[model samples]
Target: MAILKHVAGKSADYGAALDYLKYEHDEVLKKPLLDANGNWVLRRDILLDGINCEPELFDVECEMLNAQYHKNQNYDEIKTHHYLISFDPADKDECGLTGERAQAIGMEYVKTNFPGHQALVCTHMDGHNGSGNIHVHIVINSLRKLDVPQKSFMERPIDCKAGYKHHLTKDYLKHLQQSLMNICMRENLNQVDLLSPSVNKITQQEYYARQRGQINLDKLNAELIAEGFTPMRTKFQTEKDKLRDSITAAAKRAKSFEEFSRQLQAESGISVKDHRGRFSYLLPNREKYISARTLGTSFDRNHLLMLFESNALTAEREKQQWSVADPIAVLYIKSNLRLVVNLQDCVKAQQSRAYAQKVKISNLQQMANTIVYIQQHGYDSYDELKKARDELSAKMSDARNTAKSTDADLKRLNEQIHYLGQYLSTKATYKEFLQANNKKIYRSEHQEEIAKYEEAAQFLKRSSPDGTIPTMKDLRAEKEKLLSTRAVQYESYAYFKDYYHELQTACQNVDMILDTGHTQQHSRTHPKRSHEPSL
Candidate 1:
């Protein structure tokens, strides 16, 4: 936020100019007051003869004032004034005002803070986006006699460059800032520290970067290294080749070290080890090559190890348990889930837009109907009816544009949904690898048995008339069917076959218990027994 102030007008027309200035910008028009003539007056001055107003430049003052204020007003009766005042838009809200709201607020401030005198506080927007900034043009009526002695303008020549000397001063600006700060505090808005000038100046990019969590971890590591410490890398790769590939991939992704480390662990099972032997995983074994420093930036093995060690200690203190689940599998599932959710949200937003557009079209149609009815009934003159028809047509055009925008939004949403669905299907194949690595059963020994049980369950679920519980007869039939359909091998499949039946029975029992009032505790303690004779 920045502030710029200017003053224009002689004492006689200062009141009118101030009044007109109030109408210039939306924010300043709302200010409470514009004068410093009363008891609450912060400061005032009447330079009179000492105040130099070049008669030749008086026209310039009128022109400037008219350009900002009276251009749209009845100019014949409006008197122009030359008053000096400093202005800044950033402090608009601090004065308990903003946009159109500031106009009233500014007027009140002038009346209460500087009574008897008149002034105008105007506000404006600047930059690419319309960020409102307000500056006040406090024009005091010079004709109004002041109880205080006028300043000797001869002793101190009027500095036209310094607008403050003509009327407002540096102290006045400080007072205004203080007043605005108080208002801000009362309103629970952010208040700039007047003691620190730097607090008032921040670029838009800096503000946005801070909001988006754009951290400079490299700088942090450098500072630490300067203190005789090395930053560690906790991410691991499957092999030296994989590690090299990850480094290359990370550079291509342009991801931060932390983000890359997380991505690697999600894509690959290999975890990086630190000096203390703590570990974090890296991405998969890809053929890509990346630079070492670029991959982990300022992080090295030692620093990573230290971090891992610290985390391990914390986990130990908390009695945290590690899962056998592959980090990559979990990451894949989570990433896919996020994609799905994002796509869903986008779809919903598009639907909402479509609904809004439909409503707008309906409203426009109603307006058109009303206009048609008026024309048919001869309720209005031809010109009036024509105007009404034209307005309705314009509304219809706007509605069409809105519909087109909604269509585009819907198309984008559908594309995202399709992409997410495809990604999910591709990732589903990886579930087999995940189950093989983490499940209690060995795929080599139990894959066929598990598949049989899954098939039987699906068949029962689909074929059962009333979805009744599987009976002993049903289980025996399923077992017999499996034994007869499959060719006998040298190794007996009976053990695994029996185990699969037991698991299915247990699942059915659990489901039955869950339907009843029996708790999971009881179900866990009462697993189904195998009907087969003991080996």
Candidate 2:
């Protein structure tokens, strides 16, 4: 899951933002790490770029812009707004989210959302806490450097103009979160509903506290080991950690708000309170209640209500299911709600002669039900019949269009896989030739391999300009998935086509029946339908 966070800097020093992006900061000391040479140490790996300003001269440019616009003079003014996009670590393996690809995506996001700002777009392969989650840090000067076109995320008219400072709004943040979700989906990366609160939100202070406490505990255990004494506990849990665990365990089992509160109090000695439609918990020793925001969104009032409702529904469904089945036998879940045991249960559907001539149904009874069905669907009138036919035709067209798109995707993927296989097959000799003492002689000796490799290389370059090559495993899996999807599309297309033809045939039969009924009304050979299907 990708998470977005915004932090505003209050410092007047414009250079510090760029410095932070370039250097590794020690969270324990709250300062940048310095080498023996008395200079800030560069981070392990990063992809840094500038937006509307030179990255190396970012501080100078921001200062000059501030002087020009007469902004950020006050000590309390926010100098920069830092936005972080942290991606799920699993994305590296699942979605092939390399640092280069993530950085490119970050750059595109910055260009589209923060075009007018002097920004630093930086990506780190290893996250701040060494979680190995690829993340991007975008630090932009609070002041806008150029006029930008109005966007959906923009709130006020002044938001478009140059020299105006950036302002964060609820609407803007929601838009950013939604937009990030879209990008993740487009790239086939892992993502979540970021607009909703996190299930477990550990603030920076809590995270660091846990880290420090664990380190101290490990040291204490080491001393005990040296003294040849057993250490009872190896793990350290903060108060909030204990609170979160207790709440989570209780919330999962409790079916209602009252039950959840009672369980929490009984098991953990934590009192749960619902105040003004929000939920909070008071730890045993704590004087104040910890707000749901601190614990996570899962413990909030709305989410709790939803969870309770789900539990109720599940219990109801199980009870009804058990009532209808043998207690010792496990029953299959329902796909269709209606269960029919006899024809009489479906009167109109059972086929009773009133509809025989109305359509080319199997029997007189079926014919009777066919006309009943037509009347029930409001297709007895000419206009309604014509409308149904038109709608079915449109649906048939849609099926065809969708199938075409799926086919095109499958074709392109197959082509790319073929090119990839060829490239991999001839890669060894080509690489050896490149690294040879005399490359010209090596290339001549391996002419066939070089030629084949070059042909494959050219095709692959055109296919993926970003040098994105899916692993053979990934490609094979994708091919299997697309094949299954193609089969489903084929089935859908066939179903729609058959339905379209059947409807057309029924309409023709109905027209013929109407003409005969009009011509023979005076003959007294047949009586009108006594009962019609209730609409």
Which number leads on lDDT?
A: 2
lDDT of 1 by residue, 1-535 (tens): 3222233333334334433332222222323343455322221211111112332233345445444433413434324323222223445445544444544444555544443232334433231124434433444332222222333321233322222122455665566556655654664544555533431233333344433332355565565467433443222222443455643454343324464465455444334433343333343344343323333422344444445566556666544333233211111111100001121224444567675555545544544444444454354554544443454345445555555555554454444334334433433333453457656555455565455444544444444455432444234434433433332320123323333333233333333334433534665887646862221
List ranges where model 2 is wrong by over 4 Å.
27-30, 34-39, 224-229, 252-256, 302-535
Task: Return the TM-score for candidate 2, rounded to 2 decimals.
Answer: 0.53
Score every model by TM-score. Answer: 0.20, 0.53
- Local distance difference test, each candidate: 0.39, 0.78
